[model samples]
Target: MKLKLKPAIARRPRAMMGKLASAVRSKIEMEKIRRRGGPARIRKGPPEALLGLRRFVANPRQFGGFVSGPALAATITREIDPAAGPVLELGPGTGVFTRALLARGVPEHNLILVEADPMLAARLRLAFPQALVLACKAGSATPEMLGGLRPAAVVSGLPLLNFPGREVERILAAAFSFCTADAAIYQFTYGPKCPVREEIMARMELSAQRTARVWRNVPPASVYRITRD
Candidate 1:
């Protein structure tokens, strides 16, 4: 029987290939920045866009795009209390949001970054040696992954809309387990509604509020503060 190409699948490869090409270019730029000795500082020229593209090529469903610009990242991390306790960052791709948390007075040692990409995790270790970096998926986050530190806040960059309902629930539950009772989960989404599923939010007794909308980002995005009280 002759097979017909599914439109979505057929278009995916070309889009992914183009993204991979851009991602490669972005990696080259990162290597140069790494050599210059300040990996945390964001730079112009195919930086966030390239990293986002590369990640999109690797896992389109799991990432919307990189933290577009510092405006959004800084906004997402605004509520984290640097001295209150440790902070857990999910999918700290290219460390843009990670840098923002650091800029906001969070201690390097108190920040724990969980990144699914081994390559990115390796670079994060070199960039922020004091910060703990775990190379693992969001679905597998646990207190053990954080070396037993209870996080005061959770700042996530994981693409929730790309995940199935179960996976999203699992990731959220795991991250929240480490947070204090009144802590917040900061997330950014490009969609019209919150990235988190409404049912999951209701089930988890979480409340979400859009704190900021940043048009300066590559594609405009809004930051949501998710809290469990």
Candidate 2:
């Protein structure tokens, strides 16, 4: 008797075509941005332009609060205890801190990233498929968003002062709720003082102490280790 052969399984042409198109678009966009010196050009003459300029002036590597420098990211990551259970990185932008955390031996699976910008979030997801990436406001991160994942440390790249006082407090409160009692929260600011003011700190029942000043960074930056009382 002659042996029978099974028919080959066909792949979805549309799906495959869509993926190929996306890859091509991403590569083209990266090349364009690279030639322009960065990703995402700033829109000038708008009211937000001033604020964006100030942020950029403070940290040029971040491209107007879109990301943080690798050195700054490494320093912030180093502040967290190596034995910490997991790390929650807020506003991970272009995955600067995410890369730093991974370099410091934080498992990709152990990292949870909260990013607001859709473009940046998509890039981060592609860069770190193992990470739990959520595209949402930090303040709106519910327990479900966390998917039962608890973090041992919270590292923030959020422009706290740029946000409304109540909004900032809400985000910080939500972040703290997901952290352990002794969990450390590392934040950096270009301002002369800590970004979280006394009132907010008191309201959150948290205390912040400056850990290091990195003058080598553009406009200089200070790192604060915030913890619950």
Candidate 3:
């Protein structure tokens, strides 16, 4: 006579099979990534994009729920001058624009990346060892924090529209605090109008001009160049 198996024991084989299938799928995906030159090689694009999505889901207001595509980064940094001096990037989530900045001749050491997310900041530090990666909010950044380096241009990926009016001014004020007199801040927004409020701009004596638009991004975005009015 055969003995009857308990319910939990009977389910064990099915669960094991499921786990095995999952492991196989993971292995196949990893093999694909390896063929494409491994995770480190593709870190800049795919992995970071996925990381950004995860961050966005964790905090929609903070991350804006969208990653900046290469096209948008290219558009935002189109007019940047590599020789202008140190480039400050605000909210550089997966560093899409940072890569563009490097491609445009900006020295890796001359880049200042401000990321509030500690994980992203750590990754950035690993990705750009020479670059200064600060894990803090944009509004909280100060000249002292920058180590007395004045950025000639600020490439912002911050979702300014999602922030409060006062906070927006604070962030902008902080960004321009140590910048050169002629320095311009480049910001991108998904809205039809400028992300920075008119009153705030007037109060800060700043003027914004729509420089470019990239429709290839997840949500079409407009780049604005903000300068002293």
Estimate TM-scores for all models: 0.78, 0.72, 0.83
lDDT, candidate 1, 1-229, per-residue tens: 9889999989999999999999999999899888987765444357656866787788787666464688888888888878899999998888888888989999999999998888778878887889989998987977776777988899988888788999988988988888888778888888998988899999988889999999998788988999884
Q: Where is the poorest 10-residue window by lDDT in model 3?
A: 38-47
Model 3 misplacement above 4 A = 1-42
Candidate 3 lDDT, tens digit per residue, 28-81?
989887886735332755666788889998988888625678799888888889
Off by over 4 Å in 1: 1-49
- Report the lDDT tens digits of candidate 2 across residue range 1-229: 9865544323466668899999999999899989977545422234333544564676554343433555687888886665677899988766667778888888989999998767567767776878899999889897788888889999988877677788878888899889878888899888989898899999788899999887777767888999898
lDDT of 3 at 152: 97
Clashes of 3: 0
Ranked by TM-score, top first:
3, 1, 2
Q: What TM-score does prediction 1 earn? A: 0.78
Highest-scoring model, lDDT: 3
Q: Which pairs of residues have clashing backbones in candidate 3?
A: none
